[model samples]
Target: MNKAINAELLDLSNCAKEPIRTPGSIQPHGFLLALSDELTVLQASANLGDWAGCSAAAVVGGPLAGVIGEDGVQRIVAQLGPELGSHPFYAGTVGIRSKRHFDVLAHRWDRVTYLEFEPVDRAEAADFRHLYPLIGDFLLKVNEAGSIQMLAQQACEHVRAVTGYGRVVAYQFDPDGHGHVMAESLEAGYHAYMGQHFPATDIPAQARELYLLQHIRLIQNADYHPAALVPALNPLTQQPNDLSFAALRSVSPVHLQYMRNMETLASMSVSLIVKGKLWGLISCHNRDPKPVGFEKRTACEQLGQILALCIESREDARELQFRLEVRRIMVAMLAGLTQGSNFIDNLSSVFPDLLRFARAAGAAIVVDDRILLHGDTPGKEEIAALVDWLARSEHGDLYHTDNLSRAWPPAAAMVRNASGLLALPISRIHKHYLLWFRPEYVHTIEWAGNPREKEAADKALHGAPLQLSPRTSFASWRETIHGSSVRWHAGELELALEFRTALLGIVLERAEQMAELAGELGRANKELEAFSYSVSHDLRAPLRHIVGFSDLLLESAGSEDAVQRQRFLKNIKESARLAGKLVDDLLSFSQMGRAALRPTEVDMNDLVNSCIHKLAPETRGRDIEWDVAPLPVVWADPTFLHLALSNLLANAVKFTGQREMARIRISADDHAQETVFHVDDNGAGFNMDYVHKLFGVFQRLHRMEDFQGTGIGLANVRRIVERHGGRVWADSVLGESASFSFALPKHEDEDEADDGAQADNPTKQ
Candidate 1:
């Protein structure tokens, strides 16, 4: 706490900006020397006297060759070339003095060179030959590891064995950049630190950058005092030397204090790189001052590399398998959609399989202003509101969020059932989408320490940001999480993307089919119009000619052959009337095709009663017994349904005129998709073989003399019912009861109808 330190701390943001590369001191485990291109020594570590048998005062401003001798300097210089690039160049063993061997590392920055010397133990050197076979076997284990988690666990175990550390942990990074100890191996009597989460700020961005550049870092002892460099500033630039690649370069004072607070005496870290990026770290800690030589550290680095490779391989295989599953599901969905008449109608066939695409608690589909929900979900109105919000938000074709409430605050109350939402927008123009939901998950998260408490303590102690202080307590911290859910993994997102692509293709194909249907319908309509005009004109002309000629002949003959003249006149009148009947039926058939549907709840009982009343005059003389059963209400256009029912009832009345005691019955059969209404008539039924021709235009089974009809009533019935999304069919046998039935959608429960509306309709049902 001096003013300069206080100002730097006050800036809080500049914590990562600290000049760690120019720490002005080196770790006591090694000595550092700064030299110019002319072989002049600009600075040397204060501890150089311990290794060079000289004082810092004498080494300062001295020739580099005179201190370490010309031969050692020459060997380091020979290895320093353009090929070394920006990274540190390892020159293996540089020299041996006073029964000690030293490993040299050289790096250049800003035209100034810095060389670091680490003392190597002879015993560790001798152990290298014996350690190779063990290292090879460990590598084999690393490559053979089954999963990312197992590989990381094995890496920590191997590092602990080779470095003889008390504890080793493998840490992994989440998408949010937070680090968590995934696997660990520790000595007895030590507290377990596995499965503890650390905040992202624990390692600053600058430190992460250094980890990427320098693959391995080690500290012999945190309590060992650092040694200063003589002639501290570079002679050429008058600046501190950048020791980024210095093997014994002093770590940040903040980190040193953190380690001391953690009671860690010595520590080493090797970057676990996957796909050339810093995936995590293999960290080793000891309870005592334990020094690891270069050979053992090298083996740990190699082991880390192998573990990284294993992770990449396993993850690649996992991703491939996930993609295959998505592809398979997509193929199935595509087939279901393309082979059906309507995409919306076919979705049900594959709706359950869609849930298997991801591990979701519930799912929903929205298209053409219609919604289909499965499993747990919010109310229909709430979901509609959510969809509206999604349409207006900056949502891409694929949108996902673990916390739905955070994105749309209204969804906060619905977190109980739908805390997470994964949406694939199938139609941008219409805002149609398929959504997968995840229910709220109350998770108990443990931390290395109370992050909030540590942060407060750091702020009060240093009057700065709290992230610099590493948490010292390793304990369980439990809290009830709310308004959130299990995160959607990267694999799920990729799968969603695949689904969107496939769904888009299906939608486009459906559009093409619809266009073709429209064209075909247009052409058919034009043909029907032409046929109607032609039939009306051509058939009426001949009938008019016969009537005119018969009238003229009757007038000319006066009283001659009165019976024959009457017969001729009767024939002409019959022909004219038949032609007029044909024209009326053709017009009604044409009208049914052109009419629009206005759907409403229609009580079948009232509709049937109305049709019968209208035909009372024709059934006055007949002893007809009406056997009418209770009929359900349906959702359809009332006008179209009235016409369809009228045709069936009239046809029944006409065909059953011959029966002495005519009987007609009306009833309904309810089903899941639609309700079938039957009109049975005890009449002159047709043969079963001619049943197929019953609903065809002008395809009457009975002769016109037997049944006085235009032969187009059933055809009109078919057209009208089909337009209302229903179907009409008939069943009859010769000399038996005949039944004509039509199916329609059950709109809603009869109880749901308003009492006032029911009274006005006055139907039995």
Candidate 2:
């Protein structure tokens, strides 16, 4: 008994992999003929002799013309073309052996053409005069319908009226491949299947594939015995013909049993294809054997095509409207983003809008380790764990799932609030993301029957063979679904991606602004440290000297030694003068750091001459050789540049005072990007090792007696040059010549120069 049960389970699993295409037989209501490229008959159905008045074996090796007559064969040949591969081409009604009229349909597969012949039912033949107007009216109603449900109802009614079936239904498939009867038209005695659902397994995967290939299928009588091919295979290829596109192809035994269980003896299905995929079907079922003629089935096929277009149109318009709504909500959220300084806070403030944008029940804004939740959501710990999983799984920037528990096992614990998830990564480096969640949509599904009844019944059939059959019950069976939410639509995912892109832009902008501010703060702190050091050490020296000299003068006031008193007073006066000079220089250096740059075009030649003129008093008794070269006009602040040049030239003259003939040269080298101006002086230059300290306030390599000035001159020069978006450096050899050079951009951009200045001395702004 257990062995039999195992065999049944194995058989049911194998149903999905069934090869229904090459059934090696066809329905007895019609006969099929397989012909080679040379027109010779390769195979013939056993039931063909009933109409052709000749046995199938006698016609297997003969030409097709021998069975269908020469004129009939010519008609079939003339209609043969490339279109025969995709669908059966109707070759008009032809008399077989001049005894009976049959509708001739031809299609090609694997180097062989299959000719299917169904006896023409004259009484049910389609009248174009009636069908053309009926189809027009049906199309008009389909267009006039405002919704999908309404269109589906109209389609069912029209199909039922035309086919005269006992019942008709418009069956639509969900994303999970389950069928739902959207609309139905039924006779008084027929069972009502409206609003009922069918399991996805009711129609196997292979059957759905055929539905896409063949737009329409008709089963004349479910109880009729299948007519086997005479040779059981095509003699040319020694294989059964692929009857996927054949009009009278044999139905799968399981599917035939499915119809019998439903009390439906004959049925026809017209595939409603949208965008080249099988969207649904317009199914017609009859209690008694019913044969729909070729013309009538063609009309029904035409209606199905029209209905597909209408459905596609409605769905597209609906999705477009949804996308537009998402855009509007996104715009509002982004507007809110700009109003706040913090990204997470701004996003949190517009949480309601975000929920609406994603059509989600809850949302979470995660920035690094911080997680902010809004509306219905899992606990913070759960959300963090989910994010960690996502990061490790590497599902890319965007991920969405209707059943989160299936993708992540731990999510089963949070099914109530996080059954569905949509995640958009903002910054992978920081683990920043935007996640939307949907609560589990607990609902009861009214299936047409217990979808698992067949398996259950198989266990009872202990000694039965490995044969699968349909369920015996059609009663309403309610099943409660859990741990899942309504699936996310394509349009919803697309809008989320768009929102992510826009959000990333905002995030990047904020990051750059933060970096800029950080840089400014660092520079300010360094400047403050340097300023404090200079005030403590450099200013203390001058004050100490003055205090010492004053004390000496006071002590000498009562000595009555006139010469000694004069020397003491003189020392005090000199110390006081030095202290005042030091104070003034310190003030000037501080002012330079806080000064804003007002730049303009300045001629270096004129500036160099001006500096020389100002130093005339200092160079009066000195033998100085000034070699000034022609200089280029540069973009810089005139006041700052003048101060810098005066300081450099003054140093050159003062340091070169001991020379018999001192030489000072001012020259500039022009390059593609910048102009480098250098001041060379044959002076008492310092050692090169202390060059880094040359730009610090009150930093001096030479002693006070050797260089008789505060060490703020070179520091001032550096500050001024840097403010103009230029760099200053000095190269010197001990007791030899020194060179100081500064380079400025040839064409300075005002904004860039200002930014550079602010970066160097942020206190200026």
Model 1, 1-765: lDDT tens digits are 111123233334345767778888899887878777776887888998788777777877778876777777777677777665555567656553454667777777767777777887541222456457656777677657666777788778878888899999999888777788999999886667798877676677888888988889999897778898787776777888767777888888667656766667899999988777889999888878888877688788878887776776666555545645664675576577767877877776787777777678888888857888888878778888989988888587678999999989999889998899998876645758788889999887677766676567557656665434455555667556788889987867865764565455455445445545677564344434444443545344545555475455445453434346446546655665555456545556656665556667779899999999999999998899999999987777788789989999998999899899999999999899778999999999888898766776666688766777766788778776666556777788788889888876444543332221222111211
**lDDT against the true structure, each candidate:** 0.73, 0.80
Name the regions of candidate 1 deviating beyond 4 angstroms: 1-14, 55-61, 75-82, 92-101, 121-131, 229-240, 462-467, 520-765
lDDT of 2 by residue, 573-662 (tens): 465456545655655676676677887778888998898999988889878999999898888889989999999999899889879999
> Which ten residues in a row are the worst by lDDT in model 1?
756-765
TM accuracy, model 1: 0.64
Residue 471 displacement in candidate 1 (angstroms): 2.8
Index of the highest-TM-score prediction: 2
